[model samples]
Structure formats: C-alpha cells, structure tokens
Target chain A: MENKYHFACQLIREAGQFIKGRMTSDLDIEEKSGFGDLVTNMDRETQDFLIAGIKARYPDDAILAEENGVTHDIKDGRVWVLDPIDGTVNFIVLQDDFCIMMAYLEDGVGQFGLIYQVMADKLYSGGGQFAVVCNKEPLPVYQERQLAQSLFACNSRMYAQNTGGVRQLLDQCLGIRMYGGAGISMSKVLSGQLLGYFSRIQVWDYMAAKIMGEGLGYCLLTLDGQEPDFKTRQQVMFIPKAKLTEVLSYLKGVTI
Target chain B: MENKYHFACQLIREAGQFIKGRMTSDLDIEEKSGFGDLVTNMDRETQDFLIAGIKARYPDDAILAEENGVTHDIKDGRVWVLDPIDGTVNFIVLQDDFCIMMAYLEDGVGQFGLIYQVMADKLYSGGGQFAVVCNKEPLPVYQERQLAQSLFACNSRMYAQNTGGVRQLLDQCLGIRMYGGAGISMSKVLSGQLLGYFSRIQVWDYMAAKIMGEGLGYCLLTLDGQEPDFKTRQQVMFIPKAKLTEVLSYLKGVTI
Candidate 1:
C-alpha cells in the first residue's frame, strides 16, 4: 500500500465520521454568495483538520480549498487541492450522499487523490501508478462502453439551462442521474457505475477525481473538447474512451 | 400506528436486508427487453418474497407487482402495489440507491405506502393519518417551497423530448435533479430534501409515494391537468402547493 493512499483512507474515514457526528447537533450554516450555495461549521472544521494534518506531516505542501483560500504556492514542493465537503448544500440539507475530497499533486503533476462518500463509508483513492479502489476492493481499469449502454450523471446547471446539446445527450443515454454533488457523480464514473459525468465545476471539485480518472486511462475533457486548463471554473466532462466522441458532438455549440 | 404501516416497515426492512445480502453473490442478470430494462435474480427473489408474504398474511387481498403482474382484481377488497426493486438498473449495475416500494390501497383509495431506500436503510412511510418517519426521526410536514427556492427531480423521458412545459420548468426552477427511480426521487420530496418530482412512471412506482405526498398536502397532478389514471402509465408531477400553479401553467399543452 502506498503511504499516501493509506494515509488518505485513514484521514478521510476519521473526517467523515466526525462530520456526521456534528450533523446530529444544531448546524451553523451560512450561504457563500449564492442563495443555494451552503457552507457550514462542519465544512470549516473538516477543512481545518485536513490542512493541519498535511501541514504537520509535509510542512512545505501547498493547499487549495473551497471554504478557505490557497495556503502555499503551486511552484512549491507538493500541492493538495481539497474540498473538505464537496456537497455542502447536500450535507446541510440531506445529511447523506455528500463527500470529502482531496487531490495531492507532486510539484505540478496530479499524483494522488481521494473522493470519499461519507454516509456510504466508501472511499475511492488512486493516481501515481496506483489502481483506484473503493474501500479495499481494487477497481479494474474502466473499459470502454458505448454511449448508449450507460447512465450519465450531470449537474443542475446543465438542466437549469436545458442546453440543446445536453438534451440531445440525455435523449441518447440509457438514463440520467444527479446526486447534487460532483464527488458522488464523479465516483460513479470512476467505479463504472456511470458511463460519464458532465458538469460545470471548480478545480477543487474535479481535480482529485480527474487525477484518478486519468490514471485509469479515461478522457477528462471540457464540453468544448479541450483539456481542462484548471485556471477558471469550467464545464468539464469525465468520460470513458468509447463515449467521448458521441458526447462531445452533442456538447458542441453549447456553452457548457 | 396503523397495522399496515407497522407491517410495511417490518416487511420492507426485511426484504431490503435480504436483497442486500444477496447483492454480494454473483447475480443472475437478464434483460427484460431493452438494455436499460434489467432483471436480476435478486429482483425476482425479492419480488417473490414480498408477494409470498402478502399471500400468506392476507390471502384475499390483491397484489400488483412490477415483475409478476397483478395477482388479483383491482376491485378486490384491498390491493397492494409493489415494486420489489424500484431501480433495477441501479441494483444490477451500481448495487446502490435502489429501493423497495409498496403502496396499500383499500377499496381503490390510497391508504398507506412505503418507499424504503435499502442501501441507506431509511424508510419513508405514512398515510392512514400517520406522520412520515425515516428510521425513528419523524419527517416534519413538508412546508411549501417555491419552485425558485429548491430543486426538482424528473425523468429523462421528459427532457429527451423537450416537452415545452418541462424544459421551461426546468429552466425556471432553482435546479433539476433525477434519481432515475420514482421511489427515490419522491422520497427526496417527502423528506423536504427536494421541492418537487416530475416523471412519467408506472403505477408500481408512484402509488405509495403519491398517497404519502397527498397526505402531506402535496399537489399530485398530471401535466394534462387531470387526476392520475392508474390504468395508464402517465407523466405526473408531485409538487408542493407553492410551485403547483407555475409548474401547471408550463404543462398546459404538453401531453404528459
């Protein structure tokens, strides 16, 4: 077992259990600019926990987070992009299906990442030549399944607009699903439960999953068929090799 | 507590646990018709389990099921509609988020229903003047939320065709979500986690949920502005009273 993967499983398991315990108490929730965008005490506490742990073990590490801003320079030794609670709104409202996510980068390249579905107690970790695994079960490399043979997970932003491309893709897929969070949806694709995922998300949302998915030999492209620049929040699609072309054709001319 | 509600929780919980145990084994998967139409041994085994239990306990009562078809006349004294595995594709593929659903009708009147999310071990049950409870926590009466304030869950069939009303509503709402199963999506609304649900679903899918939502003061209406005719699988929207008018206005011309 790689030290990073071992450390991730233990750290995320503790964070998930701790956050779930806090959910039973009265939650202190506040909106982050948007009305539906939620952040809570648990989110901050969990974020701080991860940051403190990384800083203690790797003092030179860089940290970029959703709740709190960046800690160190990406040009520095190791950088970790973390979304302590990816589905903060889901966390505040449903208390289930939300996630704790992290991506560890070596210098500049994506190396290790974890997307943990807390309520379900399933942690997906991989990258840097490591095979992805859910719990302890090693996930085989994702095989290319046709676009018509699988379900697609998407964010609400796509539906709120009902883009023609999105509508076309939804029509062609076997079915559709949304968990209101990038972590669970991405995990769906990573574990082969879903064929692909389309969403407009931030670096903190997709970086970890992207790293792991790339390690599995999948295509991580923007809806416009460009590699994700990771500079600004952009529309991204993590798809299996077989479905990439078909999904991209549908996504053309749409500002995903 | 009504005998039916008590019975449903006990029956469905047992079924859920039994089916989950079987999921670890090698599943016998066969196609019902198309690729997305899945039927696993667990689905059949669980459905038969529920049917046999019903026959043993209430031999005279009618039963309607997804796999085995109607066991008795709809005009019989009491009819129980059951979908042993609500999300069969999810069950066979992802092995998570599938549900066990049942609705009991007495002389053609919706009386009590159970929509149990098996993987999550949370059951939503109500009707017969009982408050809905998930596990031991009683779900509060669903307060009306605006269409602009919360999310809506819908089926891809509506989006595939881009029914003018459906697209307009999706574009206008806070966001849109799809759980791919009516039982799970409706559970989201019943628990106040989602604002509404729109889907073209079968009797086995919506009967129990419709009964519980109606009991909680939700508006259950077809897009064509008529009462849901159980005889036909029709497009139905179960929404809060606050969002009903706006949603209905969008559905005026569409044949749901």
Candidate 2:
C-alpha cells in the first residue's frame, strides 16, 4: 500500500465529510455553459479544498478539473484530475445521488482513483495493483452474467436523444438507470449491480473508476471500440470483461 | 390527522426497520409471472406482516396485495392495497433503492398511502386531507414551470418500445431519468424533484402517492386522459395539476 493511496482515501473521506455537513443547507447553484450542466459554491469550494491540500503536500502535481480547467503540465508527470462534486445536479436539486471524485495519475498512468458517494458511507477506490473496495470490504464478484440480465447505467440525455442504437439497447436490457452522476454509475458497475454504464463523459468523470475497475476485470472503452484517450471526453462505456462484446455490439456503428 | 394515517405511518416505519435490518443478507428472490417482475421472501413476509396487522385491527377490510390476491369482499368497503416490496428487483439485486408500499382505499376512494424508501430514512407518507411529507418535512411547491425546465422520470422500456409519442416525449423534456423502481419515481414526482413520471404501473404502485399528490394539486391520470380507476393497473402518470395538459399531450395516442 503506497502512501499516495492512503492519502487519496483519507483526503476523499475528509472532503466527503465536508460535503455531507453542508449539503443539507440551501445551496447556491448556477448552470454552466450547457443547460443542466450545473455548478455550485460547494463545488467550487470543494475543488479549492482538494487543490489546496494537494498543493500543500505534492505541490508539483499537475491538475485537471471540470470547474477550473487544467493546470501545471501533463508531459509525462504526476497529475490529479478532480471534480469536487461530480453529481452537482443531484446535489443541488435532489435529496441524494452525488459523489466527490479525484484521480491520481503518475507519468500519464492512472494510479489512484476515488469516488466517495458522500451519503452512502462507501468509497469506491482503486489504484495500481490495488483492488477496488466499498468501505473496507472488497467488492463482491457476481456470477458470470449475460447481457440481457444486466442493468445499463446511462445519462438521460443519451436515452433522450432518441438515437437508433440507444433506443434499441434500452429495449434489450433488464433496465436503464440514471442516478445523475458518473461516479454513482461506475460504483454500480464495479460492485456488480450493473452490467455496464455508457455516457458521453469527460476525463474527471471516469478517471479513478477506470483505474479501480481494471483490477476487477472491468473495461472502459469508447463507443467506437477504441481505447479511450483520457485527454478528451468521449462517448464512453464501462463494462465487465465477460460481457464486453455483447454490450459493445449495442453501441457499435450507432453514433451515441 | 386521521387515525388510519397514523396507523399506516407507524406500521410502515416498523416494517421498514425490519427490512433495513435484513436486506443486506443474501436474499431469496424469484421471478413472478411477468418478465423482470420479481418477488422475494421478504416481500411475502412483509405482506403477511401488513395483512396480519390490518386483519387484527380492521378485520373486514378487503386486501389487495402483490403476493397474495384479494381477501375479503370488495363490493363496497375499506380496502388495503399493499405491495410488500414494490421495488423487488432493486431489493434483490442492488445495494439500495427499494420501498414498502401501501394505500388505504375506502369505498373506491384513496384515503391513505405510504411509500417508505427503507434505506434512505425517507417515508413519503400521507393520505386523506393529510399533505405529503418526506421525513417529517412538508414537500415544496415550485412556481409555474414549463417542459424545457423540468425533468421527466420515465422507464427505459417506454423509451425503448419506440412508440411515437413516448420517443418524442423522451426527446423533448429537459431530461429523462429512470431510477428503476416505481416507488422511487413516484417519490421524486411527489417531492417536486421531477415535473412528472410516466409508467405502466399496477394498483399498489402509485396509489398512496396519488392520494398524497392530490392534496398538493397533482393528478395521477391514465395515458388516455382519463381519471385512473383505482381497481385496474394501467399506463399511468403522476403530474402536477399545473403541468397536466402539457405532459398529457405527449402520452395520448402514443403506442407505449
């Protein structure tokens, strides 16, 4: 267990505690450039909190954030991609369904990724050879599953777009779910509650979960069946290794 | 408050406590007659628990339940509609998102309804002249809203079915969401987190919320633009009174 992993876990727990404490109050929320793309004072403060902590200890680490954009460098050095509150809409509007997200990338490799669903008392965390675990318990490995029996976690926008492939995929699966945050959906995929999750997601959205999921034999791939370039957001999916082909077939050739 | 409403709340709280205590263990779940319809031993026991309580107190009350069929004559008497576990799929397969549901109808009128989202400490409860409240706080009412500003809670099956009106509705709303359980969706609608919810649901599914929503100036109507018959399960929707016609235009004449 490296110190970085310990720091990642502790830092997220602290951030989560801060979020839980203040989220009950009336929050100041505003929409970002896109409709339904939301931001809030808590999100900004949480980002500042994480950045301040990282800068205090590992001052040279590069940062890529949803609210503040990129900082430092990514020419093969340590970088932390952070989205202080990943499900801001759920946070601002709904009673639940939000997460605090952060990922540690070393030399362009995802080392530690953490998604702390603040209210659930479970931190879905993984990095390096580390296995993803909820709270202190290692994630359970479910029985080998078929595509038809699995749930798909997706954003409403994708389903609402009325795309040909998405419409077909919605009909074929056990169900489609949207909990309003990438980290929340990824937690379901890692824990075997969902067979796969697809979304037009950004870098900070799937960074840590991608690192955590790999150890459980899960994969995050683009809809076009290419390995994802973390530098840019794309129509991406995370599916179990056993069911990749079946899930991919639903997304192939059909633009998301 | 009516004594029946108090009884409904207390009974549901106790049942919810029992469910929360036991839900984490491996469950014994089996499929019902319909595809994706599930029932667990907990469902049966909870049904028995509610029926026993009601029978002991109001012996002649007719009961309509998910696990057990109708009991006692229902020509014109008090009826208790109960779905011991309304979100059984979520209960048997996931970490959270299941509820204990019950509605008390007298002479074909919904008098009391309760939806207890067990793990989340939320009991969206009320009936008769009682107002709906979540965890003892009254639900908030928003100003007049339009389609573009509201989230529509819907099932993927509806979107997947590729019906003309549902597809168009899916594309038109500000966003769409499917939380996988009818109880969960109805809870969102009652609390104003969603503008509306559409589903092909059964009697016990939205009955309690329908009772509660009515007091809040909300209406639960069949897709065909008729007042719902409490006796039959239909393609139904719960929409705020202010947004009824707008949402109705999307559902009427749609194949879904």
Top candidate by TM-score = 2
Lowest-scoring 10 consecutive residues by lDDT in candidate 2 chain A?
A68-77
lDDT to native, each model: 0.79, 0.78
Model 1, A57-92: lDDT tens digits are: 778667888886665454456788888999876776
In model 1, residue pairs whose N, Cα or C atoms come closer than 3 Å (at least 3 residues apart or on different chains), thus clashing, are: none
- The TM-score obtained for chain B by all candidates, in the order given, is 0.93, 0.92
Model 1 stretches astray by more than 4 angstroms: A1-8, A24-45, A71-76, A159-170, A242-256, B1-5, B24-42, B71-76, B160-164, B241-243, B246-256
lDDT of 1 at A217: 64
RMSD (Cα, Å) of model 2: 2.8
Report candidate 2's fraction of native contacts. Answer: 0.51
Error of 2 at B227 (Å): 0.8
